[model samples]
Target: MAQFYTAKQRVTTKQRITVTIEDLDPFGQGVARHQGKTIFVSGALPGEQAEITLTEDKRQFARAKVTRLLSSSPARVTPRCPHFNTCGGCQQQHVDVVLQQQSKAQALSRMLSKEAQRVVAVDEVIAGEPWGYRRRARLGLQWQNKSQQLRMGFRQEASNDLVDIQQCPILTPELEALITPLRQCLRELKAVKRLGHVELVQADNGPLMVLRHLDALHVDDREKLERFSHKHQLMMFLDDGSENLTALSNNQPFYQSHKLKLTFSPQDFIQVNDAVNQQMVARAIDWLDLQPDDRVLDLFCGMGNFTLPIGKVVQNAVGVEGVAALVRQAAYNADLNSLKNVSFFQHNLEEDVSRQPWAAQGFNKVLLDPARAGAAGVMTHVVKLAPQRVVYVSCNPTTLARDSQTLLLAGYQLERVAMLDMFPHTRHLESMVLFKKT
Candidate 1:
């Protein structure tokens, strides 16, 4: 067990130390060691020297904030966003793009090494166009009574406090331009006080604003929204008791191009970066290499993003999701897309899949897109199924490493791994790996 620092001990002690930033943690924080204990410092880059103030010291590790950069790495760059420190949206904006990819790949490799007892090499990071990539976002609206101003943006790191942002360089230009107008709508609406949150979805067409209101909307507020939507030509949705939306009588959703045409709902979880996501999905399918007679299993499939496309080339595809609603939606997406070979089923994959009937079947290939908590329990089942090849798309490297160990233990060999720059200007990395049974 690790020792816990008492409140009295924490308040009395202040330690000042200079340490060389050794590496970056999975969360994009710089890591350093002093007296054989680890400390995490924000805004510090590897190969840089910095002064750190210990905020919380535990038996095994400590947390800290960088007070001064004694030396800076050449890879460091000025952050594009003014709210880089306060807003928790993008952490690695200050780091060079090439360095960010290296950090992420190293983080994944380290985690996998610890669990697998073997060196794992991560492929070069996939690059995407940096700006105007974010297509989906949920903007927080907070009316600061003292300032008497409405703030529209994300929350500060480690606090419920909202960071008032005038513009976000990380978001698409279309979405960033809406920040001021969104606040204007709030200012005009008397019932904006009842608004819980606002969702901004950028379909290929244009931006769609879904206002989630907790209380009833007054007639004047509704009229204000209608007028704003009409003048700006925006598609607006008001959430009453249900998520059912009534598009503003005057405006329609914008369409960008036929190639990128995609629809989104307020409640659905869409990838924030549109351009990179399209590439990421395409890469997954390409790596899977679906054949006409191939059977594919998409674990943790959400809304058939990958399943429907893979189904187009395979004999049949089954998408299993934890949420029943998502499974239904995925099935609906298959039907809507005229994909005949795709089907969806709800299954609690975190738990044992051996109990499920579908678990008994073997497939020629499998595609997994698990959450930050990677597919731990399902890896064993995957080994037993022993598909010729397995393609895994991961959001978190630590969990991916642990699961990689499970696969290795089950006699699967890691063939190749590559990082996808889905969320640029951030420490967040989306990666894919291919595995084959030994």
Candidate 2:
């Protein structure tokens, strides 16, 4: 008898609402309120009024897409790329480049402050070229049955449909120029149906392309790929989800930073933006205040990007990576650079690393460049090493905040924090924070 009545479900009407954007969320979505609930609107900016149609509605917040713009912000500008609105590659393209960096920096500072439960000041935003800076990209390939053509480009926002792009302004000139030619070559290839994805990298040597296929190519298809490689003067490789990289060209692919050349395979993970990467490395070294006789540890070291550079200045530097191949490559790179004092170890950082022999070594300084998951599990073991200084480079702020809380609780105080605009015009945020043991 007490539970006789049942509450009716609230119906969400798909109606357009006009609201003034008050702020920008971390993902560059405009924040507004409707019916006492928060709503995030895409393609809308702060201090602007727009008519938005709700795309999603939840108990706490809703998501919407801007259908009409009643007013515009002074910070708004025309996007440079023709596929800006359709392509999912870049967000915040309509906002001024400088404003984009500032917004990201502010967002990061607020996040860190909240996480640390104290006021945190953000240093000047480190930025580079806003366009044509992307040196690496994984392009999608789709066979369009309706047009009897193969579409090559990034996927549309929130859709699997590929945005057939002739050229992407964000890609380096060398890589951008290959788009049309690569498309044509793929269309002519007999192995077109087996194609999975195409990767383009503007290496220090030259443009290196990797064609991923589901199955092996025939002799004729291989000959065609060779011809394409020769015509474009590009180093090419073929990958079929195998560990080995089949070379299509003899030319080696490499990149340079901090006066060191790093040779890598097409499948290797390297920073896409070289300019920002160099700056970030230099700043990391400067902030660490490396001593000539000090020992340093570089965790999640990929092919010695930070490891080799730090090794050059330190008495002893040890690089640790989860991948065995990367660990071997790190050692090779160290040797290539004539860095005799560097060493590398292969271990899974997410697991218990305290038992590792290298973990017992004392380190005065530590540098962590972890992926989005952050170095939470590794931090526990790292604390045992008791490094005097720790510098964390993070691509995702949420994880950084979580890890920073752990570091703070472990008697580390944040010294300096800065944002690196590694990927401009996108919601991705890269930040570096220095922590000193209290």
Candidate 3:
């Protein structure tokens, strides 16, 4: 009972004070202050003065919602997309690109310092073409049969309700053109009740859509889909409970990349922005500085995006993934590219990987690209591998910070880190770090 006892604190509203944003928080909120306490403000940017209404006042930090921008920074720019505020797809579009990258780097450094008691240096920002870079998107569909109204888009910020989007400029022209027709296709279906959502995927030749249905499609509905697929030259997938290939429609996926050809299933997780993804892959491989005798290990390798390329430079490389389907695809990509030294396997990476055959082998370099949770479970195995260098790609700054601490404990020093503006006009920042075994 004594151990649970703590100091008594009373709650009271402090005098409202306006402050300029100094940085970005982990959740993409802006960091501001009043009277020595930090305030997390939504929709505010660094170096911008804003009037905010206090939502919650705590012992350390306060929560605020921006009421008005008193003075906008010169770095702020007008967002292109009309759904900027309504659609929850992106954040940080209001901030300039350079400042955005700087804020993200600071966030990474701060989180790492707290976790590891060391500062990580972030390299130059890797940016791409700001617009029309998204190759694929899974749009939400909600059709009101009685009202004859259809809403097809992502949900609004902090709400479950959908946003009606008539046009999307960020996607390829072919994909953007299908949004209207796809909606019409669902409306004309004989069994519209069975329809749930449509997955629009951009490919080499055209767009492929997989319709997820609650019930099986009727004969007329099937015919309508066939006709649409034929007329638009679209590859259509109908899934009642399972994926099915009803008609043989060939629509190749079109990828606009100079060096890398990335192929992925719409259902699979591929970086939505093609341009930035290519830049990221190129930068990672370039920083690795591979040699002929080098052997590399790619952890959380998704469809061999980085594995196959690393295999190109080194004597041999191995990719480990959790999903069998992706492992199979990665192997196929290696074979298709005629890359002799590359191999892939499927294993649950969250568990111990020491039992694997390659655990005993030594690699000159290693690359880790994990999900938002980051790669905490494999740090011990990574250290055991004892590569000369390690490159980590991360989505979440908090998890990245924690993992950096683990790497630091294993005798690696943060050499360089770079923020990639993969999801621009949004708060999400992609970062990469290189560590040298010290």
lDDT of 1 by residue, 1-438 (tens): 999986764456578899999987656788898989988988888888998899998999998888888998998898888899899888888888777777777877777667767787886566678777887788887777788777778998888888988898877788888888778779778876666778877766566788877788888888889887777666788887674766665444432221322334556666666566667777777777768999899999887777877887889899999987677767766776677778888988989888786776668798899999889868888888889889888998767877877777777788878887888767676788888877
lDDT of 2 by residue, 1-438 (tens): 476877999997788999999988667788899889999999899999999999988999999999999999998999998999789999888988877887788899999999889989897688789889999999988887788889899998889989989889889999999999899999998878768889999998899888998887989999999999999999989998988989977887888888888988787899999989999999999999998999999999988899999988989999999989888888888888899999999988999887788887889899999999999889887788889999999999999999998889999999999999999888999999999999
TM-score of 1: 0.90
Kindly list the per-residue Cα lDDT of model 3 for residues 197-227, writing each as its tens digit.
7778777657788878787678888888889
Give the lowest summed-lDDT range of ten residues in model 2: 1-10
RMSD to native for every prediction? 5.2, 4.3, 6.1
Which number leads on lDDT?
2
My TM-score estimates for the predictions, one after another, are 0.90, 0.95, 0.89
Which model is ahead, 2 or 3, in terms of lDDT?
2
Flag regions of model 3 displaced more than 4 Å. 1-17, 24-28, 114-118, 243-248, 251-263
Order of quality (TM-score)? 2, 1, 3
The CA-based lDDT of model 1 is what?
0.79
Clashes of 2: 0
Best of the candidates, TM-score: 2
Comparing candidate 2 with candidate 3, which one achieves the higher TM-score? 2
